[model samples]
Target: MGDQFPPDVIYEIFSRLPIKSLARFRCVCKSWLKYINHPYLQTIHRFKEEPTPIIFQLVPSANSNKNSKLCKISVLRVNQLGTITIEKDHVLDVPYKGWSHQTPVLGSCNGLTLVLYEKTPWHGTLLTLINPVTKQRHDLPPVKLRDTEWDCPSSLQAAGIGFDDSTNTLTTVFVLCKESFWSPAGINPPLCTMVHRLGMSSWREMPQTPALPICDEGVFAHGRLHWLSNSDGFHSANDGRKVVWFDVKMEEFGLTDAPKGGQYGQLVDLNGEVGFAYKDDGIHIELWVLKREEWVLRCRFDLDRPRHIDVVVCGCWNDDGDILLTSNGGKKRLFVYTLKTDDLKEVKLDGRCEAYIRMHRSSLFSIRGQNYK
Candidate 1:
């Protein structure tokens, strides 16, 4: 008999193996290595498997000294099945002294983090893309919007990072504008947005959108960068809540309208799909999914009255997904939701301080279906 089994049966078996095992099995033979590293294998790995859970450190109030010194970084592998563990307390390490409060931990792509730091004096803010796990950091130079215009001390800036697998390069994009010029004045500010590709020493100005309220959170997924827009109240004529997506490959911005019937919810990725959660009548928490240009309500869970749990949606897949929601109002207790069974399980963590969880890479593997087994 030939050394190969049916390709369909091989895929079925491989789809169930964890990424670590698959990584080791890549050296089984030349054919095995070739099959595992194939582009098709990477595609299946990217979309088929469940990612490890990571936490985004949400520091307590600025007045709390005990928590102020803590570095707000993302923690991975807090929850998983057997044979997986997260030994490190924090994923990324910042060497700077003192705390940069609310510095904004943007999304992480390809083992790197897009962090925004506020510095003093002429350079008001610094945008950095660092590989926390690898300790490799790239600091982007200051972006000039106009020939004479410089960064304003009072203005707030937001940034995001995305990696192009095709080119194996990372890109950082920043949007800076006057803090007070958000309104539709007769003369709007010039060059409100700028983008900088890696290895370039300077920033390039880009066309600005029509003054939408910027979001506080940013994430990168599927080769694009996304952020929530609070432009609902920008102009009396415009709707209030919208989500904006910036395509890193194409360098364009597009808006995805919010669900028709929700208020005060956060946007997150659930198994690859864009997910949202909102508290309805303070009694029920509803999770919604956006797929193929339609918003569908997926699951709902009842919350105890006046408990005020902080819910943060992470990522999803088809009918099942994951959510990291804090139950104790102090960020001490965290719970994960499995949409398949609509079950909410409290994540038992070893650390006492508040922790953050994010979704890492996923893949597929087949052991017994092939000749190696």
Candidate 2:
């Protein structure tokens, strides 16, 4: 009986169970619910239990009559025989009508996914923090920028979300570029930066910004938000793209060396560390993982992908440690790369519409202490 065991023992048992089981047990009693919701227990459970790899597939809206876009979220289950199965969990109907095949997961940390609400002629760009399992959504206030004062056209160039362990807070960083055609000669519009805390009411501008323009997506790992830059601003001629990282706690920007390879590279989260995968040639794909602040070669394999399908390495599936790959090129396929066997297996996804698959580390816990309203 739970009543006989000490609270510590009960906490340990509850922390070891799957998130779903923990959620169910929360209904057992008020004490159990409080224990499960405690910050200490939540952190222990998160570190002790591996987060399951979930796939977020963007497909046509389920409501045939509506012109809105839909996102189908599913959990991936892999058995010992390497057979993969999908279990549908949730579906999100994006209210916007101008949705494309582009991925909406701007950043994700601790089961919280950050999505971009594109700016329109009427309003500025907005960010939202969503927990698919909890079905809780936090729409961030409009990003504050000085470009509006100058009446310049500003676009969201890069965005990322990260968790600050020291502060126990979730933070988001944005990079915006403002262009004014009537600017004086020899003066280019400066890139603006904004930083926001999860429960904050508004976004605050960062004092400085990355010297070079950051690529679209950013990967959160090791208490920092990282982005890949194609510009040759910081790196020498020998190095291709530069890896830029922002410390969520320190609120500063730093640069790290990227592995030598092709011009285009993708950043992924391997467990809790950062991983980089790039194509050396048209056929060979090289993956490097960051260990002890150093980039170590994980594996290399020949990838025979569909024509025009741009494959990006989605992090490893914690169940079997197999590498998951998806394409941002709007293809409804998932490539599971087995490291030991050195084989690439394709998992065809359902739905006739094109899809973009993203690996999400999910939990069933609610996102407490956020400004949901």
Candidate 3:
């Protein structure tokens, strides 16, 4: 009765196991490879209570020593109310061959995170992606840099990751600017735009690039990579921030005017739609959803005297429709604000607040009209 455990039965049982265990079970049989990587199983892997990604902070040595860690990250566990009850669980070993300054993380999509590793004087820099759950780290090919060319930075510039729905594969995108040493039009900023797909052999440079230079890392949403850009460089007095996006399916770069507001803002997912959350650096805060290149104001709040702390809109916590806000207090005072009920909670975790926070968007919608085991 070996056939009693039919292929369908085995898949049902295997898909429900923890992601780490399911990854190991893939080696139980060569045929399991196709099943474990199946779209359905991958979606199921994301539904776990974990994945409220906190910054894995790496503090450098204060002794002014020559050698120090680039950065440390935090491991967080979810509490009963689905808040981040920060705890140390795993240490991510990043494979880089340079100083602690070389390991600036770009961002995280799904369960994967992209970290930039600077190469030795012999090598340039490598964009590496690591899956914290599976502990599978993949490094992209080294980016070639010219001796006289100024270095193109990734952290403050632009770095992002997203999924290509067409290929059903996750792709990490990196944009590097080539310095125009001579004339204004001599070189194109963000001249080198590259994409590295998971399980791929090498990186692929794109033919087109964004016109404006990216101000920071890309925020992935709606199957696209979005970043705030400065058309006139960061020094311009009227440095009107614009939203630049790369369509994974079309492989095209485009830009639009960001919602008119303050500099303290971020792009977050609003009920499966592209959302913009901003604070005026005062008591006023606004939330808007993208509606055909225009923004529709969804929510606005004005905090009172003592309650009006610098709040950063992170994302919607759960199905309760409460917006999550992290007060910009020092590391010692980690403030959490729930918008719906005007409730404030202090997250006194051991870990520092990560620069980039990614939401978990898991669904089994991809399995429709597909063949399965």
Candidate 4:
């Protein structure tokens, strides 16, 4: 069979398959394993659209009764009709023993997921990047603070990972802010933005953009990391702009337009474009996708469920128009909203203390590759 098909054709076929199938096919032969692990194949796999039904959930150690430092990841599969089945589960144990803080945020970028551990007032922050498919993890040292004299409780506010097109490498951006005692006075304590290349041992500090208060996690799309600006005053009365974005390629921060008349919503990656989905009343959810710097109303449908305080879009779009979402206030269940039929169904993941999930497509991209750093 190998002799019948050219190497390029075989590589293309392998690249088109799902990550799980690719993993199994690697054991077929040494040549196939080499092809699967090749950087070219990995890059192709990363760029190609994978409408896989796989979902990745990051459960903090605090969420479970266990007291281990390992990060547990649950892999779930959803059928076209929105039925979820637990495919497998695994834990990532960081070999470094410097810190044991609980994990809080899980961000995805170019086939890799970045996990940020909750930072204590006395300890520094530790970040671990893991490829769940490959079971490979890389730990980054504690973030270096510019001003060590600030006695306030400093913590990670928001974090995200993106690809730097200019450098042809992966970059992560996170915001750290010192706690302010005078909340009534509306005094925002200084914030420090940190940037780190994939293979770097240390993080470099980026100048703070005060107008954009990144209080939420970032959604990576179109070569930039975007967040819903926490500051309401930054939005114009007429323009309705609310998003603060950082360019991974240019390494700059800027503002963008959000959906007009939107009361509250979260930023999501609709395939490769920026998407915003907000609740209209209680069960009515409206989806707006960004195209050519304009917000286009994609669709609006009722969730057919009880009212939720917050609606978090899974951002994983399938060919069948199935949208997965989770509520900020609920029983920690998954709501599959089908746009075609305007039906919503709930799937209960038993014993899930936290609903930290992201649409994941695994790849064989090596974390310790020579191209990094």
lDDT of 4 by residue, 1-373 (tens): 4778998898898888888677678779988878887867877787465544333334334434343343456556434345553444544444222233323454777777787643444556677887766677787666747546542234556788888755567788877775432233344546678888877767888765535566656788888888877655543556554788888877888887688777577777666667898886777878998777788998888776756446678866465557778766434566777677777777655455353567765556657654434
Please give the range of 10 consecutive residues that has the lowest summed lDDT in model 1: 364-373
Query: Which regions of candidate 2 deviate over 4 angstroms?
Result: 1-4, 47-53, 57-68, 76-91, 97-101, 146-154, 180-189, 232-237, 306-308, 351-353, 371-373
Candidate ranking (lDDT, best to worst): 2, 4, 3, 1
Ranking 1 against 4 by TM-score, winner: 4
Candidate 3 versus the native: TM-score? 0.75
Instruction: Please tell me which model should have the higher TM-score, number 2 or number 4.
Output: 2
lDDT of each: 0.57, 0.70, 0.61, 0.66
lDDT of 2 by residue, 49-87 (tens): 555655555555655746455555555554444566443
Which has the greatest TM-score?
2
Q: Candidates 2 and 3: which is better by TM-score?
A: 2
State each candidate's clash count: 19, 0, 9, 0
Identify the runs in model 4 with alpha carbons over 4 angstroms from their true place. 1-7, 21-39, 47-70, 79-103, 151-154, 178-188, 208-210, 232-241, 308-310, 348-353, 371-373
**Candidate 4: which pairs clash?**
none
lDDT of 3 at 10: 64
lDDT tens per residue, model 3, 147-261: 5255533322567878776677777777766553223543334456877666566677788888777655677777888886654534343555678899877889998777775
Q: List clashing residue pairs in candidate 2.
A: none
What global local distance difference test value does model 1 have? 0.57
TM-score, prediction 1? 0.69
